[model samples]
Target: MIIVIDGLNRHRFGAVLDEMYRLRARVFGDRLGWDVDIRDGKEIDQFDHLDPAYVVGLDDEGHVVAAVRALQTTGPHMLADVFNAILDGEPPIRSATMWESTRFCVDTKRLGRGRDRHSVSYATCELMIGSLEFARRSGIRDIVTVIDPVMDRVLKRSDNAPYGYVGKTAPMGKVPALAALLDCTQERIGRVRDFAGIAHDVFLTEDAALDLFARGHTSVEIETAAHAASANNDTRPLSALERYFVEQMSAARTSDEVQAVIDLIDALPGTLTPEQKFALKQAPAALAREA
Candidate 1:
């Protein structure tokens, strides 16, 4: 399924975005050898800081499989600011109803090449459908994307060919790039849906998405636990028993897991600080409510 992450809901989907960025690093930095900024195993750029919306795809396992970034054309965007070279001598297209779509990618390692639900084709089409539908709902009229010739061909094959081109293609990084325009219309979306044979809703609820990641003790939970466990620089280190309890809580996905930690803590009293004891006591109830 898909999830739209923006500045409004970014905090709740930290783990998902982290995986998406890592996938981008793998695709754009390592595999494609693109001149992109990759730091701490994440491919991020100034556009990411501008509160752009991200249409991200997730597999059955809740892992991030595909993603694309959407930025409003009226403000600073990739094509206007960073990729102006692709625009040649023409002025950048800026409109209140248009958006710039970029960073479109899929996880080829986890997804296969067929048209199955677990294949790259399905994910790609799903992403296209989800993004187009989302843009249409958000009052966006068109999308201008900076993509390579391979992506251009893929768009054509998927029945999502751009309606027009902005400027001449220019050399960018290791390959040539051009700006292509696509209108956010139901006919365009229907063509992609028919090609992919998808009839269900592609978007996932925020809680549902979080639940899927919780099964694996996602990195977001780990990071949250780390922050709580080390809030004081002058505090003494956590005991082995304390550390064990914290680890268990951090990895707890179900009420049963949280209850087990609580039972263990009760059996061995005074093993944790008062604050830690309170937090552990609250874990079971929180997990129960989530369930």
Candidate 2:
């Protein structure tokens, strides 16, 4: 089962530390040839100790098949902290609501298996949603992350166009890594589609097209405006938390009132089970119509 645990006590974290280390060693140490010392199969770094980070993935019997780590941009731990000189004037990431996602890894042995891949994908989406929820509560409206070029295309297809600026070309060895940003708002959430329209610049490059498929970017042809309309018009059903948020949004008569509703939703619990959390993240707009 794919589970997302927050406030992970050090013991539970220690249980999976080896799996994380081996994963990093396999992907970064050996595959990418990063200068990481794989001591006793554990990857440790200063940022891992300083940041209030969370780990999301599965513990199948005894092996960890997938994992991703997230960190807030509050102190010396921001991505800009390490890459400041490389970025153009620090990129203003401190002023934005952002989460730096790093060390994403999946077990290569689990690739051909059906359930394992699904679990990994689901856990990843839940982590992203949880990060957005955390940002909302903290008064951060934007999310920024440096992803592998392939992963960046996956995110673009999973949502509508990203909301912020893309920086000038930066090196990712031979291929370039893009700095993509998203607005984690209810309206923007509603705008998310499984595929970007062909008219968008994303579909113009052969490399981009290949990367999209390689990363398993699920394709849904629905346009963003049409998806939002469908979500707004559908009044079929909703969960209790969904009903509560929907009614609050319906009662909102002004911009401030709408924002208040958003704030309330953002401040709600961030540690929900993956399934319940996805429902919570998607429910407000779907249920608001019924109210």
Candidate 3:
């Protein structure tokens, strides 16, 4: 599912954002050979600090699979700042109704380039639909994105091709990049939705996101998270424990790792609150009953 993280709820999604950054570091720096700064395995740039809106995609298990960043054109966006070369001699297009979309990437290792529900194609199109819908709702009329030629083709195949080009393509890092424009219109959003066979809402609530991450945490980590949650404000969107659980669970790949989480939850009845207990035990209990 897609989650839009901005300055408003950014604090609640620190771990999620961190994973997205690491994914970018892998895609742009390691795989694509981009000249991006990778400090501590995160690809964070100056624009990330400008309170840009991030449309992040998460799988059923709440692991970040794809993401794209959107920044207001009136501000110091990438088109004007980092990728001015793409604009050639023309001045940067700055307007209140326009936004610059960049850092579009997906986890190629996790998702193969197929049309399956879990493939990179589905994730990529879902992100496109989510980002465009988000921009349209936020009163944005257009988006000028700096993307490589491969991505430009992906957009066309997905039926969400850019309406126009802003400037000539320029050599950027290991590949050439150009600025492409997309109008934030319902027609465009509908085409992508049809292409992806996604009729339901693609957005996930913050609470729903928390619940998914809450499912796979190991018992010891659960106890630690529970303790941490107890110290924080009740009104916080997500507690430290939940965040920690998400970080750990996202990395869990083996059956033993999953069983470790299940075993821990099974053993921790006396420690967790009634609400926490219910949330943590419901899924496992249902599966056990079915078995």
Off by over 4 Å in 3: 216-291
Which regions in candidate 1 have their CA more than 4 angstroms from the true location? 217-291
lDDT of 2 by residue, 155-220 (tens): 665563566544554655434555667777755544432221111111113223222322221111
- From the highest TM-score down, the ranking of the candidates is 1, 3, 2
lDDT, residue 279, candidate 2: 37
What do the candidate models score in CA lDDT, each in turn?
Answer: 0.84, 0.49, 0.79
Model 1 C-alpha lDDT versus the unseen true structure: 0.84
Estimate candidate 3's alpha-carbon lDDT, on a 0 to 1 scale: 0.79
User: What is the lDDT ranking, best to worst?
Assistant: 1, 3, 2
Cα displacement (angstroms), candidate 3, residue 61, comes to 1.2
Q: Report each candidate's C-alpha RMSD, comma-separated, in the order given.
A: 6.2, 18.7, 10.4
Winner by TM-score: 1
118-229 in candidate 1: lDDT tens per residue?
A: 9999999999999999999999999999999999999999999999999889888778889999999999999999989998999999878777756544434533454454
TM-score of 1: 0.80
